[model samples]
Target: MSEKLTLHKYQSDITGLMIEHKAFGVFAEPGTGKTPTSLYVVNHFRQKTLVIAPIRIAYSVWPPETKKWSDFNNIKTGLLHGLDKEQRFLDDSIGIYIINPEGLVWLESMVAKHKRFPFTNLIVDESAKFKSPSSKRFKALKRVIGLFKRRYILAGNPMPNSYMDLWAQIFLLDRGERLGRTISAYRNRFFTRGGFRGYEYFLRPGAEEEIKDLIKDICIFIKATDHLDLPKLVINDIRFDLPKGLRKKYRVMEKQLFWDLDEGKILASSAAVANSKCQQIAQGFLFESLSDKQKYDKVTKKVYDLHNIKIELLEELVDELNGSPLLVGYWFRPDYDKLKKAFPKAVYFADSSKSEAVQIEKDWNAGKIPLLIGNIASISHGLNLQKAGNHVCFYTMVWNYDMYDQFIKRVLRQGNDNDRVFVHRIIANKTMEEAMIMSMQDKSAMSSGFLNAINLYREKIKEYDE
Candidate 1:
């Protein structure tokens, strides 16, 4: 038989990661081979690897990739997704388990039924899901972390908001040693101002320096732009002029809201004031105050209308692209409506009522539908759509780095034979869209060591001065 399928670069990185027992974060971007790098680390340490990820991703990453890599086609791997089966040997040689975070909701009873072996290593892929301290998934992962001797938190973009790392992620890394034992302690030591209720610590500017120093011996940071053989990525920002009507409405509401506030004519709590600002952004109209029920009712209607606008834009863009199969990335519910209306025949994860999702995949590869749209969180991981479409378009920009990377790789993977893949970003001018683009560029560079890409971004920024 031929030499075992091996990517030496990935193997080298795995060695480094396995040697480090402290909490490690893999900042590798989409298509930079994080899965292989992680797998090799598991193989090197000869430890049981437990992967907690989204359901779709769990199916896409392990069995298929493992078959491609190892000579043993029936290597042992357990999927703890749906029904509980009696404890089974992964393979006589190795044990690998993959479970969706949703499964963790019933994990206590499940573990009781089938005694869980102490997990040697735990890999939390797409770790941004745990950023919210109050979320059930975050708490579930926290409980599961205790069973692992070593842990790895894999994310392309771990730090989005300032408060993210303090509670959820820091707890995973070292359980309060580097950051704090609790969110309150973390805030006390590293944060001081701009938090909720006017006294919380929100942003920690020196956190990066502190993190690197503390994990100096434990963590490894790798950027994709540092790799020589990786294909060059060219990111272009396609901005659309904002509708003049929207701008005028925005200004009229802004002036009226402040005028009312300045004259002491409006009396409301801080939450009411914040809600007014949110209304302006959400619907291009401002309300002095809205009860939670009113806000919820209004938000639902506005989102429905927003979905119409997205479909309109997508139809126009699809026409512009000459009907080439387009891969559309969405984030919100509004996106789903627009996508469904525009491509009635579209195969979507949410449309499970029509046909089974796995069967739909076969239809997709067979070229049944030309246009596909879904949230990046849903479509980005584990799926290969290289045969379906090469043109990727973002219905809206996303903040999470891993989702962005995985979204692009779904079409541009290694076995893909297509030429000249085009990525189109549909952004509304002078909105959060501008900020999202800048943030993604900065974070992508940080993850992938694309020195030239960084230089190009700086040059483009300098153009504004000239």
Candidate 2:
């Protein structure tokens, strides 16, 4: 007997809409099953599909999703990345070509010189990455977007930072029919320049509504709350104060924008460099030299570690969680190294080898590997870590609001078996970490206007259903 396929009412609705529209964007929030919904449409149509996604997703997500569900098991899939890319291209056995967004230009180059374009449809995962019209990926993809008989854009938070993110994304779908053909035209219609000597453009009054309405015809917005019967999320803000000496050093770095440490062997002499130095200090450690710092140019001095305050907090969290698996989102290179040393058996998501990474993912999901640690930027957009565990710890916060918003969904999203997930933010009190969190929150608020529109549509649907 064939396997049964069951999807929620909203999932069925969006899948139906995709088949009807042929080309559209799905601003479905995380845990809403955008992957399965898109796959269903592709299965029904049986067209050769091109999926453009971030490197992590393109490598680990799409192929796994296809394999997990028997519903789409027969559809052939190939990954266009790394050394085996040419083989994947020539396989002729696969119907789906998944490529990283960064490689779109190279794909264009391939088609222009020696290859033929084969995909009849395009699915741009993490469409927000192409929010900028001037980006090389978007420009390259635009030249051939019309070649696809169908196209779909997927993003959990579609407009992560600003409404400006909407223009290029919408353009790829409707060919600038909904938004203006040119970015400048779109900007002039809804924004006015006002910030910093008229260099920045802020949205004019009611511009959000106008922009929302323009794209509503071809876009579907699905909220996780309305669709998924999900577990509760528990968030803990664990804040700590720096030691007296460390506090003084941080103050010097922040105020004077310079610091002399280790007998002039290490120095932070500029505002940007000082910012990195101070943030590192807040985390209970600092590289011995500015040259070894990632945020700025490296100095020639040897790197040194100052403390392990946050590491101590992580140790406490580990003890508190007992023996359960935990997913830790470490933000810095040093943090990853330190975390691996502290949690010896922990599995890290890395770029060691493609097959090994796949095996690591399988091991994690199968409950064999506990304490999985990954950089937030590396694992943000895609990859299903929900099965591993429900506790997600942010050892360090990130600057981009979207990454913070997306990273949590790994465990909080649909298919998670746990009853409730815990999200921990180990914050440094009175430091840049606090400032970074606040800045992200403020920027995230910019999406409330779009969410309001989504709420209104849901209400209209609820009334009709009643």
Candidate achieving the largest TM-score = 2
Candidate 1, 1-466: lDDT as tens digits: 3226656575476557656665677755555667767777776676777788767667666655676576434446777765443343223344677777776666656566656564678888867668887788888777767778888877655654444453577578787777677877766766546423354343366865765676555555565546524334445456554456665554455456445534545432222333244233432222243345754754223321421344556678788877577888876565565567668876576665312544555556666657777778777766667666568888766655556877887776654556556788876554444544665766542212222332343445443321
TM-score of 1: 0.73
TM-score of 2: 0.85
Off-target runs (Cα >4 Å) in candidate 1 are 1-3, 19-23, 45-47, 71-74, 84-94, 113-118, 133-146, 228-231, 234-247, 253-313, 352-369, 386-388, 398-406, 412-421, 429-466
Report the C-alpha lDDT of model 2 over 1-466, residue by residue, as the tens digit.
4444688999898888899997888998787888888889999999899999888777777887788789989988998888888677667678899999888877887777766887889999989989999989989998998899998999998777678889999998999998799999999999997533455567899999998898888998887878787779888888898887777677666543322321332321122233576677777667764454675555654546777888899999988988688888977677877787887777788544666666776777788866778889777766676777888899988656778877888778887878898888899876666655664555453433323332343333343221
For every candidate structure, what is the RMSD over all alpha carbons to the true structure, in angstroms? 7.0, 9.2
Candidate 2 wrongly placed segments (more than 4 Å): 1-3, 254-275, 287-304, 439-466
| Overall local distance difference test of candidate 1 | 0.60
